[model samples]
Target: MFSPKSVSAALATHFGNALVSPAPSPLTDEERRMFSRLKILLTEKEQGLIESEEEDEEALVQESGDSDSDYDAEEDEKPEQRSRKPWTKELCDKMLEFYRSKDLEDGRRGASQSFKRMQNRFRAHMKTEYDLTLLRKYEKTGVIPSVRYSAMRQLASDVRAKLGEKMKKGVPIHDTDIRKIALDLNKLNAASGNFKASATWVSKWKVHHRIVSRKVTKFVTRKATKDREKVLKQIDELRIKFLAVVRKNPGIVIINADQTGQVKEMHSTRTLAEEGSKDVVVEIESKSATTHSVTVLPTIYLDGRQHPIVYVHLGEPTGSLPAKKAVYGNKNLVIGASKSHIMNREAAARYFKEVLFVQPMPKHMLLLLDSWSLFLNHSFIQGLVPKGHKVTILNIPKGGTSLAQPLDLCYNQQWKCVMRRLNDAILVHDIDFVLHTRDNLLRCISQVYWAFGAPMFKEYRKYGWYRGGFLTTHPAPFVTPPKYMFGEGSEADCPCSEPGLIRCPYCKKAHCFSCFVINSHRCA
Candidate 1:
């Protein structure tokens, strides 16, 4: 409801509109855009006012016989929306074929065709395939918009010529590009086309744009996206910081630790890295039934064996930690579960104070942490640092955690796959122990991670750091998780010499389904 004077004054103050200000004769891009916006707003307001006032009253006016612009008349007067026509490779080629043939017939070299010819040829070509416009409409429907078809035909002809030149230049065309053109062309003398691009479509259509896309029918949803600039910047920053730390102290431990939420069931092979991100999407199942979760924090070193992993779940501790004594476990795991079942500030602080700081390690070390607020909070971490140790914290940039963190780079996906395989075994063999139970879940997570501390995984985990640009050379090769746990590569036999169903991660022994599941893989 702004008056013309008020709008002018606002534009003069904000956009420096030359009409209202004594700046200059010529306006800048901002001023021009503001003026254009003002014009559109004023025109829309005036038109709206007229429609509101005259909607109920119709004056007896004489017919001048000048209204043949898209004329259709019925009782309701609501014209059916036009169907969208995607320009496929074959269709585009056909259009160009007609253009070339017509050019040759006219003996015109590289000359644009006339609007009438173009319009007639396009109409005939569309009719041969399917004329969506000619479909029967409901009775009592009428075309409302008064647009000159001759003008629209001229514009379509111009667009066709422009696209033809692009085809000649060998630039690839996409349906989306054609859709944008179609939408823009329809805008002038426009008719709303039934092109539905919903948010659900965008979210589910998870293929990367460059990798290629698939369409369900004629709809073309845009491919999922990635922030390349952020990824590149994070990589560069990590490389610089890591090399600097290594140069300063050649023996500093480079550790990448990440806390991931493990679903109640591990049927889906999708890792936590791919959970929220649209990058590198693959369809997975068992993702929806996560009623309970366990937080698993794994610390992988760039050079040495990893420390015992910490498992956190959702509940208050029933017993207090003995202040003077250490918590003992044969599985070499540290377990805790706060009420939240997430890596909260208290859990982060506890991890440093117990599992990390107490581990036998060098005095100097470099730790890579994701930019979680609690991990970065000074008050939370200040008391957790050990007195004699030099812990340099490198904050992995936001959204760049996957690109920089060693656990996220590759190891975590493999870790989840192992967990999934475990779930599969339990389900297939009908194991007595319910992994859904908190204690059993903790035990399963511990056993998988404890196996990682073995000699085979020591060198295997270094590859993640190497891949993340921390290590100069690749580490020595090791067996993959699938081969080791599933006996995919080499043959393995149980004590009875029957074909082994699964391998015990801790005891380094193979067992049959009866022994693995029924006997709880008793290797201890």
Candidate 2:
């Protein structure tokens, strides 16, 4: 046996000093080129020598260990090894074929178990020399080709297409569609039966198709032209009646009354514009204060005029003299207390004594004031009405004055005009002039009056009377006049004898007696 070191020394001696040289550095260019080429050839030769030496060592080990006796022992062991059964390529092929066929009756029951056993043995053998992973490529291509699965999927797709086409063409219909069609046909048959059962029996006409051809008819009822015309005429009559009623009572007056404190320090101012200018503005101002000692009850009448009257009454522990004197000194208007104001006889007497000093007792004057506690519940009427004069109290609903009262209408209109005037005034004189001139106050009063008076105008129009005429003339004073009058007189004295009267219904007169009397009375 040759030792590695001895073999290397012998080879080195045979090759000489040329075989082993010191590594070069900073060689000439030509020497560098030559050395590079020789290095590559020497590396290949060294590799070949190393492989040959390994082969020789293996051969020597085998030769020295195995002799005739060892060969005989190995031969005797080979039979036992053969009996142990090593897996061969033929065995693998046969096992794979049985697995692929799935022939269990042919004695390959546990194919997966047999496959695992074969894989282990083959992998052990391959690991001794080559890698077993290389068999994975062969298994993929030959044993389990992916194209077979793809082919099966393509066959299923073709079957589905054929079935879909058959379904579309109304051949081989689905069970559900067939059931639906049967049910529909059955319904049709039932309908036909119902028609046949109700149909009249005619000997000559036995045409079933003709009867089936008839569709269900829907009867639509329509109004006749004559009926429509009648309805239209009725509607027109109703419209005319409605119009007549509206014309008869064209306007309505809503009244609202609320009271405020005394309008303190009332004053007015006049303004002059440029010489040729048409504008002349007036301003007014007033102030008020609140006090707990004296309760000033203001009665605001919202009819044809927005007049707010104030009455001061000393409340709680205050004597009648102080209250009465205070009210009298503050305002010209005075009201007397009645028995109703008395909580007791003493209070009644005291109230009477104090109030009587300013005004006579039992004067029934209707105060058109707002609905306040002082004005409501007939407090004012009971307190002020004289013993003999009958006081009739009227209360307007809340917020209704704008619609029912003459004063609210007038006030609204006047206020609107005043606002416009104030705006114009401000534009001309600047903001400071508004405060100094008291234009805002004047505008407010004007607006209130306009709002109150508008309702009166509307009422006048509705009643075929002029508001201006009534206001200026002061007809009937505080009371409304009666609609009719009658008197006994001879034809000569009676106004009915005049030529203007033409057989009046009430008097059977040929002359206009009522008109003549009305005109005369008004003039007087």
Candidate 3:
């Protein structure tokens, strides 16, 4: 198969050229030390005598009379030099066992926890007998006990894989889990006098391996899901019914009412400080005495009108004070007194008679209410119903108040924020001024009404109705079962006499006692 030219070229090439030696490449000091370490390690391995990187380097440098040369140059450059140690299989197993034994009381994995006691015990055991010390770098890096990089890497990968597999199986991953695993592995391998890993090794591994921390959120409960469906269906039905009513009576008022409490405490308004100063102190009202608050019942209509704020102040009613005189000119704000500083059935009924009833209204009206016992009371319902007003007791789906209630959704928070700012201004002017005194507190609240009440209520109208939001479709009781149906029965005959007598705190239902006992534990 050979051509004549190829055969001639092969015959002309001399085979004796293969025997000629090439020039030797001289080894650098670094290369020489590395080769020397390799040689020592290999020999020691064969003889079943393990020698560490640090020990071998030291021996080689002493033998070469170049202790200060490039042999130790690498260690000198580092902030801290790593001293490798030999680890036995026994030591590695012990570390793993120790970590496995350590667990938090709540059953969370505590293997990677860097407690002082854990580190001290490890250090003591290593030094007392083995004449070895664990480096801070190794403690942070989560390096396994073995001096060999390949072995340590494999061990780390195994532990990480186990953690990943646990997570896949629905086990919650804590930030400390990885550290615990590394610490346990290190402890187990300590008997062999091997270099253990550093605490931050897992952090590096997470970044390099693309591991990310994710927030754990609670899954939607079955009851919440059912409530949502029911609420949506009810809202649609109410929209149809309400729209029809609106067509019949164009001026029929649609109002949502709820009661919230506000304490007579001041928050920060403004601070005078230099631009660069990180810390600035604005004195807030300290709890030197028991703080008292007034229950505020605010109502907003679909047509952007806010009824007078009903401030239920604690203590008996004394005639008009300076605060009452200041607000008497407006005639829009009202204050009432309650023994407990909370709105009761009497207070609510009085509010309807004095504030809501007096407000300009059409023959027909819609009253939106929550599942409060006072709102669902017999007297409250009778007073509103006989007067020919529609009552739609909105059964705010469980955990749906923020979404369903117009006041809770945005208005109250903004109102409170504004009130706090006002209170802060008052306190800044006079720190010794007491806001809990009836006159001063009422004055502050009256100011809040003047500053924020009108504008905030206007914004509430937009959020609740104009757009395709929660209020676009009315939240009627058609598809959803209401907690209490107004005018259904007399509540006075009941033993508890309160509408919330049969209410379950756990499942948030107002029903018969037998029903409450059965479903009261927790909703499915």
Per-residue lDDT tens digits of candidate 3, residues 195-233?
323334554545444455433232221233435556666
User: By TM-score, who's the top model here?
Assistant: 1
Model 3, runs deviating above 4 Å: 1-249, 266-292, 309-330, 384-398, 429-432, 453-460, 466-524
Question: What local lDDT score does residue 441 receive in model 2, on the 0 to 100 scale?
Answer: 31
Q: What is the Cα-based TM-score of model 1?
A: 0.49
lDDT of each: 0.53, 0.29, 0.45
The best candidate by lDDT is 1
Superior candidate under TM-score, 1 versus 2: 1
Model 2 C-alpha lDDT per residue in residues 332-406, reported as the tens digit of each score: 122323222223334323333343213432233233333444445576346644556544444433333322333
Better of 1 and 3 by lDDT: 1
Query: Which lDDT value does model 2 have at 305?
Result: 32
TM for every model, in the order presented, reads 0.49, 0.20, 0.39
lDDT of 3: 0.45
